[model samples]
Target: MKKFDVLTPIGLVVGVVMLIFGIVTNGGITGFFSFIDPASLLIVLGGVIAGLLINFPVKDMKHIFTVIKQGFSQNEQNLDQLIKTFVTLSERARREGLLALEVEIEKVKDPFIRKGVLLAVDGIEPDMINDIMSAEITAMEERHRKGRNILEKAGEYAPAWGMIGTLIGLVLMLKNLNDPSSLGPNMAVALLTTLYGTLFANLVCLPLASKLALKTDQEVFLKQIIIEGVIGVQAGQNPKLLEEKLSAFLSSKERQKAAELITSGEALNDEA
Candidate 1:
């Protein structure tokens, strides 16, 4: 299945709705247009970017767009289906030997799972397999941490920049206090910078960071399942026992499907 995510669009719609509703309630369309202060925008956004660039390396900044995309993407791991497949592979390996898994390896879609199974079929020592696979998992986690930290820093820095903009605006407004007309526009820039900062931090950066964290948990869980299942296969575990062991990874609803699949012998049938 495709892993497209809906969070990005949903969050954007909600934010836009909030801005529009707040503006329309205040002074209709005029208030909405009045909020468009280019100087305020530049101060908030540009300052935030500049702050981030200083805080993090340029290479990390280069992947900001990619990291944001990943935040919105789904992990696409179906636990019930995965458990069933593992059960099937274990039974085949037990009956016909690990070499029998060679054909099945080609059908496996996830590269991480495929690599683990390939190592098992190749007769790699269980300890060696564990070492290699565990290293990969560690590296995956570190990469995820880096991406999350970037967003987190953005969340942290946004408000700081916003405050800077507010101060800048305040200074400009106070300097032109004699001109009453300039007061309103200058004050608007100050307040708008704060609003932009708050919106970006709460509505975008922080939320994306949280979402990426949740996604990392899911991907890590799926990868753990693969690592465990492959090691069980290498150990020549009984298929039924392996199924029972792997079922621990599933939720209550998924556990029911797992039980039915094992009972009906449908999981083993897939190997036929």
Candidate 2:
């Protein structure tokens, strides 16, 4: 399941607030108007968009919004609950044989887990199952990399385009050096472009790319655990031993929690 990730939006809002506060503290509320340059924004944002269009195919670019949306949401995978589920499945398979798991597999919500369990029930060889699932993981990684690359490139281009805008502003300012009154406004344009570019890159693109990368790593890790559990169930491993095996994937704190659950007999009752 996926849920709204409040941290991303909250972080963005806090950053803007901090910038506004800094400006207000230094030069009053009127200072905020000095930083708002429509021309500078156009240069930075337009240049970034053009660069992305040139860098990626139209079809791929169409999914850019979807990719960004992912950073605002997070998969809710409870490792402890997942381990308990596999242990329960292992116990059932051992008691009644692999074919008996078909009904239980239907109740599983995760397509990855359902596919793995179905393959095991179909009597596929363990090696073949691992090979198939591992290939899918590799494909998923490739797709994620493509999506993340767009954001990364946007981050890279933002600063460069900002510098370009600054150069343009400098040329115009230098052309009318005799006009002392015009220098301040021109200099503001030059400096604001760089500021806009840096802010967009650091605050938005790069952070989102990092978030997507972290999410990808987490998903791959969970899938690996699923692969292990599915194979163990197929092999008819001892339920207690299988639980211990899956528990190895958990952190020290989570391992302790799982141990406590088992010690109190809550895990078995929950499975039952």
Candidate 3:
């Protein structure tokens, strides 16, 4: 199922506000179109691309599209549902033993959870299971860092390129000083590069980088929950005790919700 995210809408709203304000301030839609200088766009965008190419390998550069797609996609982890599933699994393992998890592994959707359960069913030591899962988590973190880093570099380079475009505009305007009337027009055209750069950096690249970091945090937090859940299962922890332990990951309000789940016997019912 797809879930709606507020990030994209927030970004779009902010962008639309800037667009409308710019058009109105510049004396309507026609004047706003005058701000569109192909040369400025080339300088800002081409320079950003050049900077990215310099800072990251081509393989890493390829991930920009993937990151954009990921930003719009639904968050993969459903913590509440995950907790219930873990509790159910823990109760079953406590009763029928780890071998029973073999039949249930096929029913698990998350590959990470399934793998951890399978490892336990195969009698791997808890420490070894942790070591393997921790390594996988570390690898996931590194991949996310790579993507965030690319957007960060783009944000940094954009403004510098914009300044470069401003300088180029100044030089050209000065060179055409013989036509004094044309100077202001030439200068305005040059400054448009800086405007483009600022807009791209502040509105597009920086926000995207921040969003990617937020997404990374959510993913890592979810994975940590899974890791803890799997370890609790392996050690034959009581379902209620395991729930209490996992509840530590939530906030005060969320903890209260979990407590209600326990008190209302909803968790016990799931175990049954």
Candidate 4:
């Protein structure tokens, strides 16, 4: 459950099944015994932990953990709801005019929505407001990119750090070549680091970076709709036309609902 919800369950299940098949075909538990080396793991894990602490601030580390926690449980939003919200906001602005919306702007719950409503109500020139909003959105995306880049760098370093640990183990092993008893301990360290590096890179750091990149793209698209819809309303475009334009950000089913409302085939409570 921590790794995959119903949305992505099949792919995860298949990967696990195939991994087990590979392990079984290659002598199962007997082959697995060859990969167990504690010294290798210590170096790989120690390096990863140290690198993350040195590279990222405490606040950013907290945020990274939050992103990981949220990724597994985050709900999929319906695009239709977003379309409806824009259509409703646009229609209200058209009827009430800009000045009449000061209270609505003040009451909006989301910071992004509030900023857009405030700008639209202030009668700011639409193009100028759009330029400012777009620049802000671009900056936000850049931040997300930097965050993921940090994780990617960590993943790259982890494997290299593991090799470093392996080298140390090899040196110690070579020194004790005369003693058969010490040879096994040194060999364990050499192999363990490689295992630790591979597991940490594949299971943790790299996956987090990929997930954050995807989330950043989604947020950028959502913000674009707000910028376009608010500006269209401020310009006093036809309500039907505004609905059509905003609905473009939504899926087919969502657009159908907006169309129904425009055609007077559906009654919405928010429209006075």
Q: List TM-scores for all candidates, in order.
A: 0.93, 0.95, 0.89, 0.79
- For model 4, residues 143-199, the per-residue Cα lDDT tens digits are 777678767877888888878877888999999999999887887787678767876
- Candidate 1, residues 227-249, lDDT tens digits: the string is 88899988998887888888888
Give the per-residue lDDT digits (tens) of candidate 3, residues 95-131: 9998998886676777888889899988989899989
TM-score of 2: 0.95
Q: Per-residue error at 187 for model 2, in Å?
A: 1.3
lDDT of prediction 3? 0.81
Whichever of 1 and 3 has more lDDT, that candidate is 1
Candidate 2 runs further than 4 Å off = 260-272
Candidate 4: how many backbone clashes? 2
What's the candidate order when arranged by decreasing lDDT? 2, 1, 3, 4
lDDT agreement with native, every candidate: 0.83, 0.90, 0.81, 0.70
Candidate 4, after superposition: displacement of residue 183 in Å?
3.2
Clash-forming residue pairs, model 1:
none
